[model samples]
Target: MVAGGGMGPDDEGISFAHALATLKEQGSALLVVGSVPEELFAKASRTMLGDPDADPPRRRLVVTPEPNPESAVRRLRETGPLSAEYARVISRGERARSAAVADSFDEMTPRTHVVDDSIRGLGTTIADVIEEFDLFAGGLEPAEFRMAFDCLPTVLATHGREVAFRFLHVVIAQARSVSGLVHFRLPRAVDSEAVGLFEPLFDATVELQVDGDDLHQRWHFRDRDITSDWLPVGDRP
Candidate 1:
């Protein structure tokens, strides 16, 4: 893309040509971040298509690239671990954040919400949160981790509230397992009504579990870790 942008020769800067050549030798990703304006092209050639018009006759272009990422995630979650490809993609939080976020809708899905927002964004879901606690007696740290939804929220009350508990449960599951902090970075779409409900209540509740003490705690809801208001509690000063 750099060379294609026509980096000048006398500028002594490597053009997209050299960059592309080097990239071919050492395989790596070429991410074009944010967004770019759409370009128009003809079927004449691949490299040099039509120089897109500044403002062309805006005709319709029906191109079926693929279903939106949400559909793809729905299929992946439905398939479960059998959907290793999708899980693998999930494990790679960077590429998959967008997909996970889009599926943040509660009625539609919760598993993907746990995997993407709860796991990747908050840096929870893995036993590695505390950096030294290890289960499996391996002490090898968590190989890979995420909040896999064996079930959904029984009662969400509202969309935001559902998403909140959804986020909290995943962290509680992982935190109680080994050693880790429940870091809550609320999703942009967190139900506003539910936001205050939990936030003001439990933001200060945090501690380290040593010697499997969590196993004895009497938790409310699904498990003891189920918090009515984790983000608010965790976010307290």
Candidate 2:
């Protein structure tokens, strides 16, 4: 898991996705918590999927709480990934039904899915988010899928600890059910007391700090067999 403190919000998602892309060897699913801007999250998505030439077709899902899902898709188009042709966008944000963002990917434009107004959309409440997650998780086949949550601090701050804890517990269970890897990027600005509730839940944790143009990272693990130290942002594990 990656925790963003002094590190820029954009870097938090980008770095997390960069790491996950390098480490993922199987199908994956991403659950973005909207802690970072839509543009940065899109970059992270592009990074996580990698370039078409080096990527194999894998089951993948990109879920977000943005009002305009196209905002995420457009940033992805800018990444120049040839595989963008395979993407489809689903808009569930009730504030806007259509993705008004301009696209440069031509035929690679993403298709949209809209939920009826009768139902709640993303970010309306913690329960709504959990229900949406369950719907997404249920559609996945029984296989390995890497799951990343951009920033969980938003959840805890929005609904309180109990709700966020239940949400994480459900998400972790969903990931473990298929033996998928789960990583969450949480903002360090949150109360350390509140953040403490999540540290023990992860098998490993990473602390991210930004210094000028450089990023420093430290890793902690439950086993403590691996030695880790502050490393350059782009350095691979």
Per-residue C-alpha lDDT of model 1 across residues 1-237, encoded as one tens digit per residue: 112233354332343234333322332111111111121011111111112221221111111112233432333333333222113122333445565566555444423322333333434433332232232224322212222221112123223465756555554554434322122222112324433454432222121111221111111121122222111111101
Question: Each prediction's TM-score against the native?
Answer: 0.23, 0.55
Q: Which residue pairs does candidate 2 place in steric collision?
A: none
Q: Which is the leading candidate under TM-score?
A: 2
Q: List the global CA lDDT of all models.
A: 0.27, 0.45
> Against the hidden true structure, what lDDT does model 1 obtain?
0.27
Worst 10 contiguous positions by lDDT, candidate 1: 40-49
| Total clashing pairs for each candidate | 9, 0
Q: lDDT by residue for model 2 over 62-158, one digit each (tens)?
A: 3444556555456435433324223334344455354424433345654444443221232233233333444544643333233335436545666
Flag regions of model 1 displaced more than 4 Å: 1-160, 187-193, 200-237
